[model samples]
Target: MSQPRTMKSTAKKTTAKKASTAKKTSTGKKTSTAKRTSTAKKTSTAKRTSTAKKATAKRTTASKRAAKQTMASTTGTRATRTQATRAAAVEGAAAVPLPDFLASAGTLTLGQRKLLVDQALLILDQNYVHLPLKAAMHAVNPLQRLRVMRARMERQTAETMEPEWMFHRQMSSIFHSVRDLHTNYLLPVPFAGKIAFLPFMIEKCYDGAGEEHYLITRTVTGYSAPQFGPGAEVTHWNGTPIARAVALNGAQFAGSNDAANLARGLESLTLRPLVIQSPPDEDWVNLTYIGLDGSTQELREQWKVTTNLPPMTDLDAVSETSASMGLDLDSDEKARAKKALYVRDVVELEDGQSSAELKTPAAVGGADLPTTMPGVFRAREAVTPSGTFGHLRIFTFSVQDPVAFRDEFVRLAGLLPQRGLIVDVRDNGGGHIYASEFTLQTLTPRYISPEPVQFISTSLNLRICRRHKDNPAGIDLGPWFDSLDLATETGAAYSAAKPITPEDGANDIGQTYHGPVVLITDARVYSATDIFAAGFADHEIGTILGVDDNTGAGGANVWTHGLLAALLNEPPPPDSTSPYEALPNGANMRVSIRRTLRVGQLSGTPVEDLGIRPHETHKMTQADLLEGNVDLLAKAGSLLAAMPHRSLGVTTSFSGTTLTVTLNVEGIDRVDLYLDNRPISSEDLTGAPLSIDILEVTPGQSLRADGYKAGALVASRRRTV
Candidate 1:
């Protein structure tokens, strides 16, 4: 798919805008809450969510605090009897009882448990890509765990197994231990489409003096908390310190690293996907906070359940590389329920530009972006310490059309400030592989070499590939067949590295923005987002500015069990491999079938547990949260100001069949031209626009120009006539 007509223009002087510094907000907060379960005690313990020991300790803590918060019926400001008595309506929603809701759930028989375990074992042993790496990095080996599970089930005399949630939890924990988000045990029914959340969200930001404070960033609209809202600082969770609570929560379902764990932990404090795991341990929580006006208060809120907002479904769910990076599925639309989930989201950008005018669909950041557009791309004309530039926040790369996505970004980039651009993918949970890699070429002049991926070289994986090689309805596994076959002789743990993102799609859209581009990332950036960041750094597009030390580092192509059942089967006449059986109930799972490897200097290195570290780290400040990221942008702008300014422009004119190529350039010392990917000419710039004439010219031919600085290629341009 070709891109939209490329925007063309000469290098224009960057216009500086007056920097506006809004008052920075810090600490102090409380919030309005949701439906209180009729019996908070009954709902306190979610089956499998908290261990028996933790549950007991939590119950004890609640009992001690039960007296302190006896005035829960009143608002945080100590509401009057009349104010407390005022009625609030909750439409189409129910107050569900807690642990009972899970305890009463259907149970899985011993046979069913075995089936699930066996399926996981086969998938992990034969198809899982990061087995060797994960085995080395993580203390617990999933394969070993599966084997132990199989042993327990095989020898046990009991006909019925634990409750369905327990069984799922055990399996889920096994997958989580690997610390790969792409691979997950998705529960069925009641849980699959449900989300468990609180009415308010919390976040951490550093004050000007570098003190860390946790505050209520936003609350669910119309929840009616007059006592507190944004800017409320949280000091404790239940009876534990807020940071300690976050860490405890993270220990339950954290990702690859400490940063990822803390991030996931913080996100889970407010919202959790029932599809991925059971609800929180407690049906309700008591948040101790300092109100914005210097008043201390305790806000006790109940956990609410909702299905109003569903994650955006994959555009092409049946594709080979499509994935679900856990069920907190993000979407372009800001549905009401989604708002509740993202109130404390790391980045939330609002786009006001019309689809037609922005020529794009976009995404993030807590900033109110001007000249806004939303879909996957949201841009604004930003003013910072270094003047003005475009701030483009990419919420996710999970798009249906890569070409259209790239073109839209190109269009949006052209319309924003041309001086410099800050591309923020903070909290972006990655979507399409092609979509992520395709956009990389647009920001850079260097070749966009999509990250390479490899599968573990095992017999089961080999057999599936061999059997499904000829099945047209299934995936194209022929590319990895030869390499897998050579594994025995070579003794390589993984197959040869190959890019899942086609080279053409990766490089089809050439550089569009000429100014310096900086990428803003956090630990939540995962899967395809990780791939994108790595490519950006590898290609030397610009300096990477990270709010966290590293990204989520979920580097692999994932496949759901359903997709596996369809493609990896060996039907009667040879349909894809049919090894996996019908799982009991509606249970399904996902596995990382191929592990991605870093290119360029880090070539051959796996990106499983280790994500791309930032070239520059930014400690998010209170100004970033309440003042539209002024400090973060200021730091970014400063970096952009110091980088060398470069440009490459080309035009073709013909005189009597001779092609005269005119080039206007800056900063770059040399330029090389290629026709149909073959070298055509080379020139050394002399600070003057140069015209190179070719004796043989075709009506239409592919043309490429490579720009070099300091003996190294820095930028590239492609054209056809």
Candidate 2:
């Protein structure tokens, strides 16, 4: 698709009157509160009765003590609210109760339990990818099992069935049965808020022998200190081995990959609250750390509450990379990058001239370089080897209009020192499909045509899906269905576009660039990012580097619903203040509806379970993550420099059933020979491209040759014998 016209530039202005009024209102509230306190003190003094004076003084003293404790806790000082302290201060203040409202699952009526069971079953039936629900339900039909479980729960009293009791019991089991990572239950409570958290951030570390161990990279100040500090080796947690604890935590999110689940669990341990009426006793966490001297030190930890950190929804957010390096969390300016709309506006200069206005996008610590118009996306550029090579760090494929990205690429590609282009999407969470598709299409070479196809398939019947009852995104299926040519068994293939050729103008930014492309990928790539990775890998468009295992397997798009609201007959309004806000006894669930299929075939593998594998493998070490990926970038630069200049020669001859393949190569180091399009021989030609003789050559077999330099597949040719 061609780029669309840019949106008009109308500068936005903030109204200051409202701000001033709000400030006045806030000050008035503070004054009112102070006046009330003063009035109460005066009234107590005015009560001249001796008995009344003693009572007033006693109450005031108790209030002061409570305030002092609160202040100490907030300041991260060791303020122990021991049994003795509770007994001495604020007599009759009730101790926090166990089995809070959230745990009142057992209290639910039979009808409510049945309703929940039926709802869960329906969701699974309509959305889960492995179609023919019965077949997908291998061990035991989830629907039937849930029905039986609900029947059993129906017999229990409110006290026995705690809120989230069923979820705790069956959610992991249901998720584990399916391969969908995105399909899981959201607890029947507010997703965010104060909860129990371990005082330190934990990460998986590997030793020289490839043995796995957990390491503490960061300790929340005022929470965990000294023993659980950064760089400490975590040998155990709460009496459980570190590995075992990770496994147990992973079991809670059954369908997710171990790495993803473990990461999530650890993030929860340190950041997310462990939802309860009051914080779990901090002393419950018994941690044993292995010191540098090989001696083990055991310590009891308290559950700390945080009011600042947000939930860990992204992988990049959870990593304790910075803390381990003794760096502050706010050290990087990029940390402040928030979602924004960058309007392209031009401001007239006082010199009677108009140039594109240069307004820097607000980022945590981002730059504001002078440019023509602003952008919605965040990108950084660097040139090396005296401007012979260019590296563009594309933080995301998310943009207001994907076509704008293509235009940006056009501008970047046209720049000098375009000998190479390194595109980094290491932790991209994904956005619009068009953005990902267009970007990948622009990078791919023309000779590799007839791009691999993609499809979306659901276990539910298409007719039901089209009826729009279960359509969460409210996707318009009519236009989408018409655009695809059916592949096999509900597999829809995208319509083919005219093959891009060299005839396309050189100045065209949409056309493929001459330089080799190096793509950096990691497991965190999800949704559209995963799609781009799959296409890039299948087409052999570039050399992929980084851990390929964490490719998000959360199916495709997600649809969320409030279980409580739906049951109450008062579905939330279009702009409900809190879509996720739980009802008195309600919960929310986000389910995966369609599984994304790339290179679609009825029986072909889906992209959710099988992600793109990189040509070269690399992992982001703790140091790499903390240091802004300096090592990774340097390695990528070296690879770009090593890319061979495209110059090739090859001759194949058949002599008495023997095939002799000779090559003329420059700047290339690896040559691979294929028999009938299947690889037969590969050799490292570091010195020279030497002739090779194939002892056996079938009468009808053909020979194909491919050349690689710096891990990227550079050249290819085919010859019939």
C-alpha lDDT of residue 134 in model 1: 79
Question: Please, what is the TM-score per model?
Answer: 0.79, 0.54
Residue-level lDDT tens digits of model 2 in 53-108: 35335434543553354334424421222332223223211112223423323444
lDDT of each: 0.67, 0.43
Best by TM-score: 1
Model 1 has a clash total of 25
Question: What's model 1's lDDT at 448?
Answer: 75
Q: Residues 114-189, candidate 1, lDDT per residue (tens digit)?
A: 8888898888878888777777887768888889888977777554555566677788889888888887787766
Top lDDT prediction, candidate number? 1
